[model samples]
Target chain A: MTDRLEAQFAFLNEADRLKSVLRATTLCDASRPENSGEHSWHLALYALVLADQAGPGVNIDRVIRMLLLHDLVEIDVGDVPIHSQNGTAHGSAETQAAEARAAERIFGLLPGDLRDDLRALWEEFEAAETPDAVFAKSLDRVQPVMQNLACGGGTWATYDVTFDQLESRVGVKIARGAPRLWDWVRCKVRPWFG
Target chain B: MTDRLEAQFAFLNEADRLKSVLRATTLCDASRPENSGEHSWHLALYALVLADQAGPGVNIDRVIRMLLLHDLVEIDVGDVPIHSQNGTAHGSAETQAAEARAAERIFGLLPGDLRDDLRALWEEFEAAETPDAVFAKSLDRVQPVMQNLACGGGTWATYDVTFDQLESRVGVKIARGAPRLWDWVRCKVRPWFG
Candidate 1:
């Protein structure tokens, strides 16, 4: 019993390293440099709050699971911002490959059934198929927008984000998944543009 | 335009700081050292995957919203673990007061309507009176169990958890909110005790 307890502690110690990795990643909302963990939380919220806004018959639970585990790979691969077109152009493939390896190791700490369940959820999220994945992706895009708006143009100005670019990257997702929120964004941005 | 952008960025910056605070305070698995951000993310997933398991007629979206914002206050008050009862005994009132202040300053970054909308969500989560809160709290408890089980008894062994204590903490909530998962947990733990 004592040995089992010690082994569990050792696994948790390793999981702590993953937290550090996530803390290093930043999001589109520069005001709130998101750790990977926080990003998961926000995405989960998106799955819930916007579940109704998704297409009819979408499964909210699957979307939530995807959001939570999608970035677990980031623990090893390191975070690559979805918007950083250039960031991915270089060593992203290698980074992602490494991340997959790490994810397997980290998740393997769990009992077998759970390990499979989480790994499957992670894959489902990456595939972004079915209603759940689509909704999860939509939330991923929207969370940063809230951060950006809250932070007063956050990375937009720092990164020299043009109106068109912002719309293309973030607006398009909102339009599809949560039209009401997207409409709200359009109204909000009009005055700024003028 | 520049002024509005500046204001927005300022808010994002504060939000970023809050994320940092949360990351520092909470453990990932309750037993493992997880950042508050990750904890939030995990709970969000719990809401999603466990949506069908939630009480009938409960709005999954609202539950998700509650889970996401539930810990935003931790940005100000810092995370107080469920088991760290002593850390919170004297500090909760002070923490609650501080969190309210932080929520105002942080959520205030967005335009009035958005700010109010988010602030209200956070408030509802704190109150935990509605179906959303009950289910949200259930998810909050469940995620740590999944993490602990994944990490091989995580804090359970570290805290010297007895089977009864663990069951009491998790069983009631799961039984009420997610009977199927609770049943699964019972099955999983039976062998451990034997």
Candidate 2:
């Protein structure tokens, strides 16, 4: 029991490091770059607030869980912004491999059952295979766009992101899980992109 | 549908303000004061990581949900630190009433059903009634202590907090829902307070 409790505390302490892991997207207020921890929280809220707009069969609860656990890998690999370097490394084989290794070491800090469960959830999110993961991924994309739009093309301006690039890189994934949300975001961001 | 979507977006955008609402507790690294948003997120992670330590019958999913919604009111009324002003205003009647009003106005921005659902969750967290709420409240108190411990008395030193005050103000509630966690935390934080 003592060992197990120590392991959990160690994992939680390591998780605290995530608060210092900055992302490419700044806060909408443009004060500073949002950390992965808060970004994950905001995305979970997005899952709850926008659950109605999700694709059919999506489990909002699971979507929320996925969102909460999704970017934890960023603690290890660092955030690979979707628009960074023309979006080449965002879903690159190298990045995915790094994130998988990160998931193992980080989640492995927990006891056996928890390590397996969280690793699976992180994998489900990486795969983006199920309805829950799809919806979670959609919000994952939707949030940065919303942030960028709110901050006057935050990362877009910094990265010199083009409309075509956004469409191919971010729009399709968001649309795949929540078409109406994509439509709403499209209308809001199109003017800036053009 | 458009109105509903707009309402959701408005509420979420307003929630963006929460990221700006700072709390008394600093980050573990002592970099800056943690915002209510990330603080809430860290608490949610604590709920997940420490579920085994919670009282029997605590539902972690509900605990996570409560943590996520619990601090949105800070966007309006601002964070009233538990140890602030010698812990007088933390749960003062004026603060409770103000938070109730804040909850109504903030959650009310959502469409009817979601507004009720989230508002009710927020109230449940505030009331700390059910097993889940009890567990959620426990994590709320636990995270700050952990942060303070990690940061060399982050809030305790800032507030000149004492051992007796911490036990009465924070320790009892944490013990109620997670006695083992409280035990571990007590061992860690006792020296700092002394």
Candidate 3:
């Protein structure tokens, strides 16, 4: 095979690792925690179905790409739930440090151009600044909440996630994506939370 | 919620069905068969890592989107393995008829505009005519072959798939997308087959 195909195959083979990286969120059936592979897959579909919810004029393609690449770092660092609460910002410094390294290593396995492009997509998902990013973030936060609600308060029951923590961590982003889903979920879920 | 978000949510909720739709190909480890969800996920990542192999000037985004939506119809119709020959084409006429109906029903859950757009993407994947479609088809063919090789001739051993059968069935599409990988696999896997 060609050199580029070899590099591509290597990267593709490495991606199988994501299937084994389990998350804290249980499946809607509560049979097992969903792996990063299926979560990212489900998130990409969520981006597709919910693109309109991401505010007017957002680029759905970019958001879909962002969702596809988002949890790849979890292949390296494992999933850190939104409620991990390390007494720090979005994630603990140690976790962020680990993910950044994981991103570099995993994405670097691709040839330079593809590697740069994918790494850029991962960064875009992390920055959550662009219209696409904001919308992607909205759906990202929404999935687990929907899963939790779907399965009679999935992981949240274990975490005992309070209304305030959920509001600050998830609702803030939902409000940007679709104020309606935000309002709807709050009414549905807050009663279950402490 | 607005009508669009409601439609989107209903569609998103329904996407969980994909996780249960089993495909014929096993995971790389051959421990169990793969689901459409994670297979789609792996294929999207394959599009990213193998974008360069699609030759110059292909739309990587379109290819990625196609792969993501490809098997969604399987959620309704269930997976049809490439080797499920009943003296017809890739799949039986009944299977194709069922899939078309399934596609319409599942995608119809989305708001009209998004539903039409996604159904178009799914058809593009099915047609595999455009440059993006060709590349997407190419990777789709490559994935199961790679998985079989990874797991020491996974399903091929079970079915006793021959070199000639694989050549006609899979290699035709494989040649279009990545010929080198195709040529390499022929030499490597022909020994496993009769």
For each candidate in turn, the TM-score is 0.58, 0.97, 0.91
DockQ of the two-chain complex in candidate 2: 0.71
Give me the candidate number with maximum lDDT. 2
Cα lDDT tens digits for candidate 1, A1-194: 33333333344344444455543235544433566766666566555444556788678766776776777666667776544652243236766578679778877765455567777877676666766776777777766666666546655655565777778767887777667667766666655544
Task: Give the lDDT of residue B179 in candidate 3.
Answer: 75
iRMSD, model 3, in Å = 1.4
Model 1 segments more than 4 A misplaced:
A1-18, A22-32, A85-99, A187-194, B1-35, B42-194
How are the candidates ranked when ordered by DockQ, highest leading? Answer: 2, 3, 1
Writing each residue's lDDT as its tens digit, candidate 3 over A129-162 gives 8878888888888899988877788777776777
- Candidate 2: residue pairs that collide: none
Per-residue lDDT tens digits for candidate 3, residues B1-194, read 46677777777777877877788888887777888889999999888676657777688888888888898888778888887652244567788888899989989998899899999999888877787888898888889998898888876777667777788889988889777668876776777664
Candidate 2, residues A68-174, lDDT tens digits: the string is 88888888899998888878888899998998889989999999988988889889998988989988998999999988888888999999989988988999999
Local accuracy of candidate 2 as per-residue lDDT tens digits, B76-166: 8999999889889898999999999999899999999999999999988889888999889889998999888888888888788889999
TM for candidate 1 is 0.58
Best by TM-score: 2
Tell me the spans in candidate 2 whose CA falls farther than 4 Å from its real position.
Answer: none
Ranking by TM-score: 2, 3, 1
The CA root-mean-square deviation of candidate 1, after full C-alpha superposition on the true structure, stands at 7.7
